[model samples]
Target: MWQKVIIPFSVSFILIGCSEPEPLVEPSTVYQCAALTLTATVTDTGLDIQLPDQSYALVETISASGARYRDDDFAIEFWSKGNEATLIINGEPFPLCIEEGTLPTSFSARGNEPFWLASLTGQTLTMREPGSEQELTVEAPRLVEDEPIMTWSIAAEDGLNLMILDQYCQDSMSGQSYPYTAYLGREGEKEAGCAGDPRQLLEGVTWQLAQTASEQAPTIQFIPESNVAGFAGCNRYRGTYQLTGEGLQFNPLAATKMLCDETAMAVEDEWFRQLTEVQSFRLDAAGELDLVLADGNVIQLQRKN
Candidate 1:
């Protein structure tokens, strides 16, 4: 009798030990989506979601693909896959929500017609025009009335001011879309423009002259840290380039003294002249780089394989 009782108790203990353990709760994660930014914390039984205006407690539900959470009381649903997510509220779906990149500390803006460029880094604002440039040390930009707009006021005699709005902007000339709209004002003059980092399009690619048919066409490579080196038909050239907003300028390039044939030297001379005249750059529909000259001409270049 004692043997039977001990066997039954041992079996009960084994069954209890084999029971499933509690689910582990994950740490909080921030998601920047297309429609909104939200923070989500996965709990053992549900998910805690925090939005800009409100918060919701969501429970895990069955999903065909990806993870799905729902809060019936709030009529909210969230589905996530990899770094992308979809949010649903009141039976409306907000799809194609992607994660955001790192925040930027510096910004650049440029306008057309008169053509001006401005870069803001820390407390220094650098303004550049065709033949002039000025740097101003000013206070930090202040947000305007809880809106996504920033304004910088300068105490200079010229009454220079800058305003940047968090809005989608398209370049007037290049047709490229930017993330910010910018306005620069000075003494009754205000210039409207687009703002973003333009260097991502130029860096990490070696471009060759597309307009030339010669076997030894001019090739240019833009390196990081404001350095540029390239072959200018007859000789190799090296220089530092300045890129601000939409503007691009090669500062006093120096070329090697190696002499080539008359044809090559002529090509080099023309290339250098065009480089000097370049005021801005745009990528054509075919993805070729077009260096826009001051006189409305374009020297096209193709990406080297």
Candidate 2:
């Protein structure tokens, strides 16, 4: 006889590199040490061991009740009796011939069981008399309530300073480009496009540039969020970005698979990657943000919602 430990969900834990991650509420009711019986059955391309359709990720069949099975890399005790076994599964079947030789043994901890071996699927199991017409039929294990769970979660975005900018430039040859886009540190909903179609992120919220290169002026269309999401000139890019006191850097930046035979998009990618080092952001009378890179190259970002 054994007792199960109930871990309260209220327990606080310190997470490294994460600000504040939410916790899950433990179930009000928990299962006892009562062993359950389950059958593992094989399907076309998946393992139907029990629980839910997508429950077992790497098994050939699902199992229920008694024993369990998993791939290698587990701490549970495993055994393979030529894939054959006795059907003495409590009140279930008895003396069964499982595909013993081809099947392997595996297990994992779930529910109250710390390390239970698996007896499901591919085992050489047989029964005395399944029915009057048949001697024995191959059976799979059924997934039970005592199964394990594997999940993932994302971290919070708190106490972090961010700048949102959006800007596009057009060459005399009609070529379009986006020099800069960032989160400037504000949460407002308003705008002013006094100097032509200035970029707009929030409704009525516009950012103008105080300084310009003259040789190349950028156009803006204020939308929401930052410039990483939408079109960067004729090209489109979507990925993750990071900004520090020293500068900004983007990674795994990808774009649509289209005809970029022109140099605008190419220049846009190269220039953006090269300008990994940023100094600061400046605004103009028209409500726009300018990007100051390490090499002294500045690119004005326009908001294009």
List residue ranges in candidate 2 displaced over 4 A: 1-227, 245-247, 274-279
Q: Evaluate model 2: give its TM-score.
A: 0.25
RMSD of 1: 17.7
Worst 10 residues of 2 by lDDT: 107-116
Which candidate comes out best when scored by TM-score? 1
Instruction: Provide the TM-score for each candidate, comma-separated.
Output: 0.43, 0.25
Candidate 2, 196-301: lDDT as tens digits: 0112111122222333433222233222223344343345556554433233444555667555435555555554464355454444456445566667776666
lDDT for each residue of candidate 1 in 1-305, tens digit (9 for 90 to 100): 45544444433434445668887758877765432467888888789888776798899999999899999675999898765677787865543444443223466888888798878776677989999999977556655533344433333334677766656566897655565677878778888887765554565457899877455999987765677789999899988888764578889999999988888889999999999998887766675678888999988899877
Q: Candidate 1, 273: how far from true, in Å?
A: 1.3
The lDDT per prediction is 0.73, 0.31
Worst 10 residues of 1 by lDDT: 148-157
